[model samples]
Target chain A: MSESDLEEMFTLAVSVAKEAGQIIRDAFDKEKEVDTKLSAADLVTESDQAVEKIVNTRIMEKFPTHRFIGEETTSESGEKHELTDDPTWIIDPIDGTTNFVNRIQEVSFSLGIMVNKKTVIGVVYAPIKDEMFTARLGKGAYLNGMKLQASKITDLKQAVIITEGGSSRDAKEVEDKVKNIHALITHTRGIRAYGSAAVNLCHVAAGRGQGYVEYGIHIWDFIAGALIAKEAGAVVLDPTGCDLDPLRRRILCACSPEVAKGLSQILTHLDMGCD
Target chain B: MSESDLEEMFTLAVSVAKEAGQIIRDAFDKEKEVDTKLSAADLVTESDQAVEKIVNTRIMEKFPTHRFIGEETTSESGEKHELTDDPTWIIDPIDGTTNFVNRIQEVSFSLGIMVNKKTVIGVVYAPIKDEMFTARLGKGAYLNGMKLQASKITDLKQAVIITEGGSSRDAKEVEDKVKNIHALITHTRGIRAYGSAAVNLCHVAAGRGQGYVEYGIHIWDFIAGALIAKEAGAVVLDPTGCDLDPLRRRILCACSPEVAKGLSQILTHLDMGCD
Candidate 1:
C-alpha cells in the first residue's frame, strides 16, 4: 500500500476508535447489569455489546467492501474464522472489559486495517485518559500527538516486560502461561500485566516498557498494537522467537532489535516451553 | 486524634502533596540534571530535593514539635534515623524516582503520619493523574472522592496480586522474590507491577486487585498505604505473616482476612526466604 493509502486508513481507524470510545464513556458510571460467562472473574455487560455494535456498524456502513472481524460477533458466530485477503478491519470495541466492568478506567478501543493479510495501519484510543496511539506501516508511532519510540535499554536484565497470565477460555493454558512466567522472571528485568493487550503494546511502542508476551489474546486484542509496535521500530514475534503471523494472536514484542535478541537468549536459557 | 484533628491533618497533607506535585510536574518534561548515586538508575535530582524542602518546611512551620523524615534530607544529613514516640511525619518526595526520572508517569508524593510510632493518618497523591488517596486510622479509605475497599475475591486462584522486583542494592533478595513469585504464579490468578508502591497499594484500596507485596520499602512507602489498606478493611503484614511493625518498611498486604490467610499460608508453604 502507498503512504497515502496507509494515511487514509489511519484517519478512519482513529475516527472509529473515538466513536467506540464515546460509546464506552457513555456507559461508564451507570448501574451495570452484569452477566458472567465463565465465572465471576470473567464477565460481560450490556455496555460491552453496545460498544461493539456501535463500532462494527460505523465501520461497515462507511466501508461496506471492507471485511470485518470483532470480538463480540465472533463469540456469537463461532470460531475457526479467518480474515480475508481483501482490506479487513479488525476491531476490539472495549479492550480490558474487566477493568471497564469494575470501573477501573483502563479500557480502550483498538482498530487495525489489514491489506493482503498484513496489518498496515492501527489506532488505539483510551477515552478515560484522553490518550490516542496511532501508526501507519512506515510512519512512526505517536501517543497523544507526540512522536513515540521504544526504549534504548537493550539488556534483558534492565528491561520491563508485560505478560498476561491466561485467557478465560483456557484455564490449563493460563496455568502453563504462569509457569513460563516463573521461568522468565528470574532472567528478565521486571513483569507487569495491565489487563489490556492494546494498551500494553502501545506502552511498548512508546518506550514505557521494553517488551510484552501473552499466551492467548484474540486477534482484535493485538492486530492494531502489533502494527503500531512494528511501525515504531520494535520486533514483533512469538514467544518462541519467530516472526509474528498477523492472522495469529499469541505474541512476543520487544522494544528494539538487541533487546529482542537478549530476550530470546534468556528464554532459551530458562528452558521455557514456548512455541 | 479526634475527627476534626484527623481532618486537619488530611487537609494539610493534601495541600503539601499538591505543592510538591507541582514542583515534580514542572520538572517532568525538562532536561533532568540527574545525580546518579551508584548507577544511572539510582538517581536523584534538584527537583526531588526542592519538593522535599517545600514539604518539610510546610510541616515544620505549622507544627514545630512534630518530626519530619524525607528521602532527600535523610540521605543528605546522614543522620541516625529513629521513629520517636511523639508524632512523626514520613515523606517520600517521589516514591518511584526511577519512574519519575524515566518519564513513566507512575510516580507520586507519599505523606504519612505516625502518632506514637503508629500510622494514624496517611495521604498519597499522584499529581500526574490528579488522584488523591487518603485514610485515617478509623475514618476509612478513599480515592479521589469515592470511598474505597479492597477486592472481595476470596479464592487465591481468582486473585490478582501486585509485587515488585527489588533494586540492585538487594540483588539476592530480588532473586529470592522472583523465586517466591514463581511459586505464586502457579497457584494464583494474575500478577502485576506498576513501578510505584503507593499506586499499587491505592489500587488494592480501590478493589482493583486482591493484594500487593514488596521487600525493603521504607516507612514512607508503606506507612501511608498500610493505614489506607487497613482502613479499607484489608489486612497488612510482614512476610513472616505477623502484623507489620508500623515503623518498619517491608510489607505484605491482602484484600480480605481469608485471602490474607491464604497468602500467608502460601508464603509459608513455599519457604520464601524473607526476614
Candidate 2:
C-alpha cells in the first residue's frame, strides 16, 4: 500500500477507536453485567460485544472488501485465520475486559491494519486518560499528536517493567509467572501489572516504562501496540530474540536495544517453558 | 474531638491535599532529580520534600498544636513514632514516587488526621486521574462528590486484588510475596499491582477492586488510604486478623466481611513468616 493509503487507514482506525472508547465509557457508567467466557477469569461484557459490532460495522462500511478479525467475532474458519497477503483489520474493542468490568480505568480500544502481512496502520485509544497513540508504516509513532520516543535506560536495575498475570490459571503457567516475577523483582527497578496488554505496550512506547513482557497474549491485544512501540523506537521481539510473530502468544518489548538484550538474556537463561 | 472539629479537619485535609498535588504536578513537569534514601527502590525527589513542606506548613498554620509526621520530615524521634492518644497529622506527599518519576500516572498526594490514635479524616489526591478520595469519621468515604462503597463481592474466586512489591527486595520478602501471589492468583478473580498503596486502597474503597495486601509498607503509605477504605465499609486488618496496626508494615484489606475472612484464612494457612 502507498503511504497516503496507510495514512488514511490510520486516520480511520483512530476515529473508530475513539468511537469504541465512547461506547465503553458509557457502558462503564452503568451497572456492568459480566459473564464468564472460558473460565471465571475470562470475562466478557455486553459492552465488549456492542463495541466490537460498532467498530466492525464502521470499518466494513468504509472498506467493504477488507478482511477483519476481532476478539468478539472470529468467524473465519480454517486457514483464513492466518494472515494473508490481502489487507486485514484487527480489532480489540476492549483490551482489558476485566478492568473495564471492574471500572479500573486501565482499559483501551486497540485497532491495527495489516497490508501484505505487515502492520501499516495502528491506533490505541485510552479514554480514561484521553490519550491516543497512532502510527503509520514508515512514519513515526505519536501520543496525543506529539511524537513519542522510548526511554533511554539500558540497565535492567534501572528499568521499570510492566507485565500481567494472564487469564489462565493453569498451574504450570501460574508457577512460571511467579518465578519470572521473583527473578524480575530482584533485578529491575520496579514491576507493574496494569492488567491490560495494550496499555502496557503504550506505556513502553511512550517511554514511561522501559520494558514489557507477557505470555498467553493474543494478536488483537498487542498488534496495534506493538507497531506503535516499534515506531517509537522500541525493540519488539519474541523470546528467542527474533522478529515478533503476531500469531505467537509471548512478547518482550524494550525501549532500548541494550535493555532488550539484558531482558532477553534473563528470560533465555531462566527458560520458563515458552518453547 | 467534636464532630465539627472533625469536619473542619476533613475539609482542611482535602484542600491541603489538592495544593500538595499541584506542587507535585508542577515539579513532575520539570526535570526530576531523585535521591536514594534506604535502597535503590526507596527513591525520594525534590518534589516529595517540597510538597510535604507545603502541606505541613499549611496544616500547622491552621492547627498550631497538632502534631505532624510526614515521610520526608519525621521530626518525632525515638518511640514518638508510635501512634499516641493525641491529635496528629500523617502525610505522604508523594505516595508513589517511583510512579511519579516514571510518569506512570498512579501517584497520589495522601494525608490523614488522627485523634486519640484513630484516623478521623483522610484525603488522597491523584493528579493525573484528577481524582480525590476523602473520608471523615462516621461520615463515610467519598470520591469526588459521590459516596464510595466497597465491592459487594464475597467470593475470593470473583474478587480482584491489589498489591505491591515493596521497596525491600530482601530475598525472604521477595520469596514470600511470590508465594502469596501464586496462592492468590489461583483463588482470586485477578491481581493488580499499581505500585501505589494509596491508589490500590482507594480502588478497593470505590468498589473497583475487592481486596489489597502488602508488607513492608509504612504509616505514610496507607494511613490515609486505610481510613478511606474503612469508612467505605471494608475490613482492614493485619495478617493476624486483628485491627490493623498503623505502625506495622503488613496489611490485608477486603471489601466484604466474608472475603476478609476467606483471605485471612488463606494467609493464616500459608504463614509465610510475617511474624
lDDT of 1 by residue, B66-148 (tens): 88888788777766577787778899898877677556667899999988778888898888788888998888999886899
DockQ scores of the candidates? 0.33, 0.68
Model 2 CA deviation exceeding 4 Å by range:
A75-80, A268-275, B75-80, B268-275
> Which candidate has the highest TM-score of all?
2
What does candidate 2's lDDT look like per residue over A106-213, in tens digits?
Answer: 889999888899998889998977889988866889999999988877888878888777788878787888777777787787788888898889999988879999
Error of 1 at A161 (Å): 2.6
Residue A33, model 2: lDDT of: 85
lDDT of 2 by residue, B1-275 (tens): 78788778877888988898888777764568988876787788889988988888898899998988898886223244767788999999899998888777889999888899888888999987789999887889999989999888888888888877777777877788877777778888778898899988999999878899887777888989998999999989985688787886678899998888878776522233321
Estimate the TM-score for candidate 1: 0.85
lDDT by residue (A193-272, candidate 1, tens digit) is 77789998998888777888776677888889888888888889866687876545577889877777766666532222
